[model samples]
Target: MAQLDISSSAISIPTLLIVNRYFDEVTSNIRERPMPWEGYQRASLITEQELLLLRNYSSRTGLKDQPTAEKYIDLFLILINKLSRMDALQYILVAFDDTIQKFPDTLVYLCQLEVKSEGSPFNTLKRCLGKDDDYLNLKAAKIITDLLNHASPKFVQTFDFTDLLLWLNRQLQSENPNVVDVSVQILQGLLKLRSFRPVFYGKAHLMNIFMGLIQASREGNPQMLYQLLFCLWLLSFEPIISDSLDKQYGVISQLVAIAKGASKEKLTRIVMATLKNLLVTAPGDNLAAMVAVKLLNFCDNLATRKWTDEDILDDIEFIRQELTERFQKLSTWDEYVSEVESGHLSWTPSHQSDAFWKMHASQLAADRGRLLNCLAHALNVPNQDPTVLAVAAHDIGQFVKYYPLGKKMVQDSGAKQKIMELLTHPNADVKYRALVALQVLMSHAWDQ
Candidate 1:
């Protein structure tokens, strides 16, 4: 690995300047290159030639008192940023990884140099539908990717990656799928910052990023696709952005495809939760389509599984209830009954209150236990009748909704699962009543 003393100031400018003049003709013409939409390309990355230049620059930077130490560090990084080959970049990173830490100012200039390179009309990353081979853009993107991978959050932010964010937006529009995928990856990293996220969200250009992520989700590799979904999750945190993104892309179908193809390997829960957020913000018609595709079953199946993670279970439960409620609206009473028999009915409407069960306030606090015991006894009588179970489910649903006390009682007792299990009863009415009970429980849980 190559090492440079960033604090040193003793260097032969005349000797290095002579070497640079010799290599300028043989290697990259890295002077003050302009950025695209911002100028022209000036650097070339011939690896062998760059190695020689990097070595010469590294050696001369050793003089501790040399005031020009910062300048040497700055120039070497500029040349590194312009490197077009991954192998060349990997070499630079390995060689100077430790040395770069001593100079934040050099990191800042490296970023500036990347921007300038992209602005060159010959820039590789700036393309749309019709395109030349995206050499410069692709190379620049790879450098950015590597830099982000190895950089500290402080380093990246200190250099103000917001301009890099803007540059990435342009790359995402490129016709070359490779460029778009890499661009999404960079944006995904940038969104980790609360500060940087709003910069993207503050403007209309966010829509472009939204669409780009969705497109990449479909076409990108597994890692890229996962990052894309995670990025979508972050974007979904804003109600307005998620709503607008849904209006533009209606990504439910894409999300569904991803879920279906997930192979139960990784990201299934995150993908499902993101789908829930999208469902919450989605238009009515879009939500109805979600129901038509049986989204509730998707989550219910996952939520009921013993191995699901706690957060994932909670996420699935939330989506299950939300999707079920919408499904209930779309389903007929008979259809809901069918769902019960098939163990597919997941939602119920609000429970109806029975006048006889409504307690007086003063006695309510004192006799709550007595009232719950009486209800539990009535519901727990097995094989008595399906009608009894149905009534029990309905009554409990109403009691839980109107009185907060009922939730603790039901949770402490076996009533919660028993009520849920009734959805599988042979009699459709019994199953329907169980659905009513579960809906109330779900609503209460949601409130908690």
Candidate 2:
């Protein structure tokens, strides 16, 4: 086994004294055991007296004043090193509780030691396993795993593990591209241990925390955005100990909102990647489709003339494909259209005759103007496709004639300017259709 030279390490003088004494006790116990395979076999056996002495030493050293305690810790470590050689399996198991209970602070110090020693503790533990007779190595592995699972509240409060994670997240948000890259590498290491996951996931506000991180990346930190997006993707896909409804809702909703409002190109790309991940991993149900549709709507709204022609075509095609896939399983056009249009499932269709529209006439009036503009655009398509023109004219005429408030809304809406513009279009068919929609509005206005 590779031995660590704690003699020259930063371990305090008092700790060294305790460790050396414990080592002497363990060495003596090995000598008294029955002979087996020369030196190695002798080192493998531990006696009851040695176990009691080690436990007493552990308790006393733990109770010593800080200065004395530091010196005693060094001694305890010496014993651990000697025991590592002897394969003192039962004694090591018995000693663990005392070591853990009596010297809680030691774990923190050891973690720092491990970090400074370039994973020396892990290496030593691994080597101890090489002697197949070393039950101590197996016990140590279990203890370490337990420590990770049972990370105490006091330990967390005193340490910066959580803060370190947050700091890394902040660094990722830095404008410096290199900082973001380094931050991601650091995060990868931190997340590798199973013990750390509960802490990461236990934050009741984790969803909000991640959302804030993503929002900060919208300016110029695309790399940070990507990292945050990937983190969220992992969290959503990772197997959690228990399903949490609130967390699921919070994470998905915040992600959808971010995808909709994010403006940076890289951030948008990351959001799209996250959305694709969700679509693939999430169940094929109404809730999932609703989220997918919301993202699609946001994408549709952001798809502008400023985008390259190819981009526009691609955007449209993507939306079309998703909608087609989502609607294909539905049994009816109305159900499918409702879902596509609003991204919500309608468990039951309304039987009332648009009564809500009548009750909120003024509110609907404001929206009615935009609907008319959409109607005008559909009617004025250059080709004047007969089917489209008929649908546009029919819907517009019906709305105007059936609803008394519709004519009043149009007159008050300042849609007259848009109507005039449409009337002067170059295509006679388009011009004629615009005139017809206007005449319908006018006839309704006169009746009113």
Candidate 1 C-alpha lDDT tens digits along 156-185:
444444446566666777676655655565
On residues 261-286, what C-alpha lDDT tens digit does candidate 2 reach at each position? 65655455544544443544443432
Model 2 deviation from native, Cα RMSD in Å: 19.6
Q: Which stretches in model 1 have alpha-carbon errors above 4 Å?
A: 1-72, 76-166, 173-178, 194-220, 276-293, 305-311, 321-448
Best by lDDT: 1
lDDT of 2 at 255: 56
